[model samples]
Target chain A: MATRSRALLPISFVVLLFLLLYLGLYLNPRHESDDSPMIGKLAPEFDLPDLIATGDRFSRADLNGQVSLVNVWATWCPSCRAEHDVLMRLAATGEVPIFSINWTDRPDSGGSREAALLWLGRLGNPYQKTGDDGENIAGLEWAVTGAPETFLIDVEGRICNRITGPLNDRPVPNPENRQEVRNNVGNIMKTVRKMVAGEGKCLTQDS
Target chain B: MPYSRFMNGLIELNKGLRMMQKQLIKMVYLLLLLWAPLSAAAPIDSLIFETQLQEDRFKQLVQEIRCVKCQNTNIAGSNADLARDHRMKVYEMMKQGKSDDEIRHWFVVRYGDFVLYRPQIEARTWLLWGLPLLLIPVGAWLLLVQLRRQRVQATEEAPVVGALSESEQKKLDEVLK
Candidate 1:
């Protein structure tokens, strides 16, 4: 029995090593461990003029008293364009209030307030309120690598989650690959519902 | 006579091979010289700093910070717009008299610990920082085990030094009988 256990030791170790590597495959670079550290922290403060209404200001305090979504969008970002419909679908549900930051709306980035106005005019605006960020003053604070990142903020103005890529609800055709797939909108809705039930503080993800 | 000629032919063939190998090595070295600039120097030459101290700090900070967009590259080496923006931010902060720690902490707040090139020795990074120290003891233990095995093998190979002679064996047998 001692010899048998001794033989099984290395075998069990190899099995564990293989299992770790297999689990590592699912732990992609954008895995939960790589999730933004801004989670569970107060939303970064920024006071900007409204994207549509000229006189109105939108700031961190505006996000208080309710759970809401803050999406970063720009005309130059095609992914933002692609996910506009998802945001529209999500907005129609009235599950949560959706706000936006018109990130990098400057001439150099091929985006301007007029272009944004035209795009929203054509595409139908889903944002409840849009903050103009021509100089990307807020983007730097929010750690925005690029446009089209969405944030979920709780009632107290703490960030609950941050979605890095375009939100999608498309079905994964292969069931076996489901573990790697992100049902972004569905998951966001689930989190939103849980938050509405008063549990929106960012839960520690066990990655 | 023919065997010597064959030997001479083989010698000439070897000389030719050696010459070709030398030429190939020279070509590779020349190609590598040309390839060096593209990887080492990116498009960050346009940035202007006020003083040498500020410039030095900017350069150091850029290398010490990771480019979120590129993930693998330090911000100094990445040509991505975000990296460029980060470089500008670092320069701006330095001009405003922000300390290095403050600038680094600012980035940490925005981008998290991943932004740092050298992560802090915290609970999450204890394994990463302590790995080299951990390897020292492990290596010492492995060497000890290896030395012990070698010593065992050495002792087994050496013949018994004081074996009984044939006369002694016979005397012992007679005594026993």
Candidate 2:
């Protein structure tokens, strides 16, 4: 019995060590891409002036009673430019309305409403309404770390999932975006279709 | 004539001295007027505080909160735009009469516990906060067990002190003879 217990100790210790090492490997790269704590919480409220259509306003009220996408974009961010095509395609699908926050388009940040409007005009206006968040007040309230972060809001306006990087159609040529573009539509459309089907669920990490 | 001349010179000197004193006081008042607006005016950032305590709280909060855009740099140390926004956010919340804890909760909710350098003792973080304390007793117990084993071995290996060996006793008896 003594010898048997003694043999079990090192085996258990080795197993525990492997378990810890496994967790370390998984946890190390995750801090920079941590899951949004905003999941399952109500989307932060904002009343922003529209970017192009100057007289119009986009607020939390706009997102109400609809499962839609709130995208954070800035001309300064290159990833946002990359995601633009995907956004246009997504908008064309007419599956859901995409409300955009043209985040931090002030001169200091090297982005302006003109630049945003010009970009949208040249490419295509994919947004339902583009909010000019020049001051970044709404951006700050939304906890936007950087541009090209997209949030999926449920019918009740609770944040279901947040994609930290740009949505892409094909794999982005950049090696850095490999993790972000894993079968793009599978990440979004699968969950979106379910939510539209009245599942009304929030956690999409597994989905 | 000399007395009158001397008295007139003295009077002139006194008048000049009085004028100089008045000018000096006026200059002091002018300087004070310049200083008052600056002292009373809000700082360049307009982060004016009703009390020194609020300013200190703001200072403490920025120091403790991490800038989400940057790795490892606190909001106070970062020059990133997000950091500036967060600083403004801190100022705004403080102005709205939110306490430090409430302000911390605001950030934590938005950015998770990673935002705070000093995390709260919550469900997921209790292990992080409590493990070092828990180890103290565990380590003490292990040391105690090892020490007891060593003591038993020490007693067994140590030479008996109450009596000599038979050969040593014989040698002693012979010496005495």
Candidate 3:
């Protein structure tokens, strides 16, 4: 009993120290959500032929004086479909120009380019312009891996933010699926507004 | 003497002819061996990385780093196609003569320091690197305390063994005798 009692304090100290060490080692990687990868880099330069036949090409130069969101999506991507409403609403805000980069879509793969055109036609064109990246040329240039990824390019043609999933701005959150919400459209707008008002740095590279 | 010389010349001529046939046969065999590969499997002229090291080191790096998509699995092991694509990107960068630090820096530029598996030892990570060193002394002290307790217990139990039974004593005597 005496021996057991004598050893308890050191043992407890060691256990506590180990626990503290592990906690410190493991917990250091997490950061706040608004920390995005595209925050500070110059937006990838692109000049894709417009998909909508709006008689104008979609180019980074066109967005020089405005803050815009470039959403990389495909009709085939279910998450894109899910996030469609959020994008439509964000577009309705009309404060920021929202552009869509349509990625590779096959007919058997949910919706093709024709189907996407039809869907957009029926839904009312929310974007000022759209680019059809059928061969994934823009995707490779932007280092885009898949669809439903969004980037917030500031007025200076610098990529200010990149949200790697679907956006949800509704008060009641959609049931969480495989793609966790990276950034909501509302949050992105708030950040852009703050940056424009000179309230706080928008985590973007100044052109 | 003339007959013997003629016979010797005939023998030399036969030897030359046999040599020529052997050479021809060898040449034909060589041609066949050269033609066999072309006749069968399609020519795979592409460079492929078939070795484990090429795959594992990249995987090891990715597993340690968090996926930008899924907050859990490292980008290397994540089933997310994005994660696979990131692994491929890392591999391609490594091939392009980028050092591990440079690759890490590239990710940091985009994702910030949150992408690193082992966060750099900086103002925010002093405690992380220091904790392992700190545990050593604590572990040693615990071991010392346990060993001392064990020694004490051993010493305390020694007295009980001194009281031997009479039957044991009789057996001992018998063995001695």
In terms of docking quality, model 2 is medium
For candidate 1 chain A, which ten residues in a row score worst on lDDT?
A: A171-180
lDDT of 2: 0.84
- Alpha-carbon shift of residue B170 in model 1 (angstroms): 42
lDDT of each: 0.85, 0.84, 0.72
- Model 1: lDDT to the true structure: 0.85
Model 1, range A27-48, lDDT digits (tens) per residue? 5555464578888889988999
DockQ top scorer: 2
Residue B40 error, candidate 1, Å: 6.7
How many clashes show up per model?
A: 0, 0, 2
Question: Where does candidate 2 chain B have its weakest 10-residue lDDT segment?
Answer: B37-46
lDDT of 1 by residue, B106-142 (tens): 9998888889998867898899989999999988998
TM-score of each candidate?
0.74, 0.72, 0.58
lDDT of 3 by residue, A1-207 (tens): 988997898899899999989997787455445455555667767888788895668877876767778888888788888888888887888877788888766553456779879878887677888988776656655656567888777767777666777788855444474234346565567677876776233453332
Residue ranges of candidate 2 with Cα displaced over 4 Å: A1-15, A23-32, A171-178, A199-207, B1-53, B159-177
Tens-digit lDDT track for model 3 on B29-82?
Answer: 999998885555222223345577755665566666667667655775465545
Ranking by TM-score: 1, 2, 3
DockQ of each: 0.56, 0.59, 0.23
